[model samples]
Target: MPVLSRFALLMLFCLSLVLVGGNSNELRAESRPNVLFIAVDDLRPELGCYGASHIQSPHIDQLAASGLLFNRAYCQQAVCSPSRTSLMTGLRPDSTKVYDLDTHFRKTVPDVVTLTQQFMKHGYKSIGMGKIYHGSLNDKASWDAYPTVRGRGYQLPETLAGIRERTKGLDVKKMNWRQRSKLTRGPATEMADVPDKQYRDGAIAEQAIKSLRELKQNQQPFFLAVGFLKPHLPFVAPQKYWDLYDRRQIKLAENRFPPENAPKFALTNWGELRNYSDMPAKGDLTDEQQLQLRHGYYACVSFTDANIGKVLDELQRLELDENTIVILWGDHGWKLGEHNGWCKHTNFENDTRVPLIIRAPGMQAQGKTSEALVEFVDIYPTLCDLAGLPLPAHLEGTSFKPLLSNPQRPWKPAAFSQYPRGRVMGYSMKTDRYRYTEWQDRKSGKVVDRELYDHRQDGAENDNIAGQPDQKRVVKQLSAQLKKNWKGAVVPD
Candidate 1:
């Protein structure tokens, strides 16, 4: 066969090796960073990283170590649907008119591009898990492909186990006139018995890992969002996490009642129904029950932390951490007896304030905090800027890339929030030192309620200084600013 045949074969082998090496390098060079967006439902900044004494969120704290932690971040609306819709679409609730669960955003912004859609348009495989949208029905069309195993959500603990059997005898619809109610706590025996090996949070994290693994093999850019349904309601979690908190040692609010100078217009009826149903007018909940509920809330937070830890671990394991961007946010804050409110349906800080953290490779500021006034709408432009995409023309939010790059930069004078309706219509202008709100009855053109608080002076916002003669000028100034920013649209109550 001779030397000539052998030399030809050697040259062919060498060419194949060179081509393979070049292709591998090309894959590495073209690899766009992955994105992991985590959204929590009804979670306040109650974690070790956020300076909370009761909750444990080490995983999130570590993630913050690699990213930017927003100190004064807020949601557009306090409720789930409107808040989430505004954030996802990069539009205000008034602009989109998505005030309730019944309103689909497609109706408002039919041709509008969603964050997921924008990512997809830019060649990223956008995937949504759990409650990305307000409802489960519309999730499929929004995401590139919604997986049944990883994308679906679960019911709360009340429906998770034998509690379902216990609750069968009790009807949420028919149970009436109960002055107060309580949920008993015990070992989380159902954790092992749940059909899926993964808990709801665990399932989401695991699927995120799986998606990353698939991207690793295909060499494609990915945008994966994991939505954790925790610290929300019924406060159910594994018993081990419950054991972490001492119920007897829990601290109640110092100002349990309304403030001395609280204005009538500053009044809110948000949690009245929950108060009538489950909260006792006088000594309704036992000491044990109160502690147990607090324990459950914290436990759920820890459980969520563990799930976030899992996804972070996977990102590192896949060697995608350096090139990936991570964002964690909550739809809104929940009121656990704060201001006598159990849920978010008001314009107060307790109901509207949420946690928002972003971790971007090469762009992240390690252990930095930004107090810049930001809205949920701003998330739209922020993500677009991060991905090197053009901002949408219709977005009302201003991009904060400059501030993100430099945390100490000056920002807007105040963060604006609205609750638009006839009499409930109000505007909340929150600055570093004050939160001013004016409630008006639209029909009669009458000032129904006015509120002003020096946040530094009253962090909890228990006192109202709106009507004080000394503060009248300040109120008028804020009123003028409110009129300037009013979007002139009605949001359904």
Candidate 2:
């Protein structure tokens, strides 16, 4: 053959390769599934799938069986604002400078796209209902179209009309010794009868089902975020849920009575205990009352589970289950009297560890469990990867694609969380088996709280063996890692 003919043949071969690669890319993009983003507030890993002995969460368990359940997932911050901010923006709490409930991540990453924004940019219709973000005051702009009437999963029926009023009468400011004593212990009320249609959980379910139905008819894919507000404080639920679990069956948590094994300074940062009038503070709530409160919490969880079931049922009914990616994540873990703490704020597992489940259509293997150390910040990149969307340049989290596909795949060795004050030296660190926190008192030098726990032995974090001679080596190694991996060292303006 002549040289010219040989060159022509080479060009043709190269062109064919290019066409094949391009076609493959198109196929992957076309096959990407719609995302059903489910966010729950203040939930711990108390689901049946996560091996909770008592609490019933059949809906979530079923979802987990059909998806990937992350066992050792940690939030960037053990509070709502920072956790949600990090999750939404794919930035760490320190990097975003959103350390409190009052501060939003917008100040740091003003032009940054949220998970919803990214999905919308890629031709997906984004809709959010209920408590997706941390909203104590109001977030009118958070959703695309927040209904004038409370969206589903956020209302109480007329039958329980006085529930809100009862919640309002709870006073936290009266933390005087007498008040704490008077409030401790006793049964308040049974789950009692309440109209199902009027409850917030039911409302959220109705709205989500409606949205799923509408989305099924549309040609465009959607990113529908259904947020459930429950298992949080003032754990109120329809009486039916409360009756499901007998109070005697409620198992006592390791450290439920009050603040123990915690520094006084650490306890001071717990504003929720002081702020939420409906919640019990230290020395308040007798053992029986504590049980009642806990009963309410568990019942609310079941109530939330039922609501989730409704949305899921709609997805199947609409035949959208095959093409949708479902993800259920709690903003952060709540402290149900763990480590002598009552709520999330500390870096303890009960506070920082949240429940994260992802079902990526046919991409994920059913009934898989991943123990990979993942952070809430990783949510952004994982979703982008699943959708074949380019991850924004500013995202700080790595996609857990490998781990999601194969649950036993090894990944990050540690997770990070941060807590900052307006002017204090603040606190931040990397955590694994050891929790290394550095607290700075404006006027004083940095004080380090290095707690080392053999998770194999101390899953409850009952003992803080920070200064133990035998654990010094482990603490030193973790300290070095903490400094090396500290992503949010500088405070954002």
lDDT per residue, candidate 2, 452-481, as tens digits? Answer: 556666667666666678877876777777
Clashes of 2: 13
Instruction: Estimate the lDDT of model 1.
Output: 0.70
Residues 237-316, candidate 1, lDDT per residue (tens digit)? 55666667776777765655655576554445543323322445554345555555567678778888887898889889
Which candidate number has the best TM-score? Answer: 2
lDDT of 2: 0.71
Query: TM-score of each candidate?
Result: 0.82, 0.83
Could you tell me how far off, in angstroms, the CA of residue 322 lies in candidate 1 after the best superposition?
1.0
The positional error of residue 229 in candidate 2, measured at the CA in angstroms, is 0.7
Error of 2 at 359 (Å): 0.6
lDDT of each: 0.70, 0.71
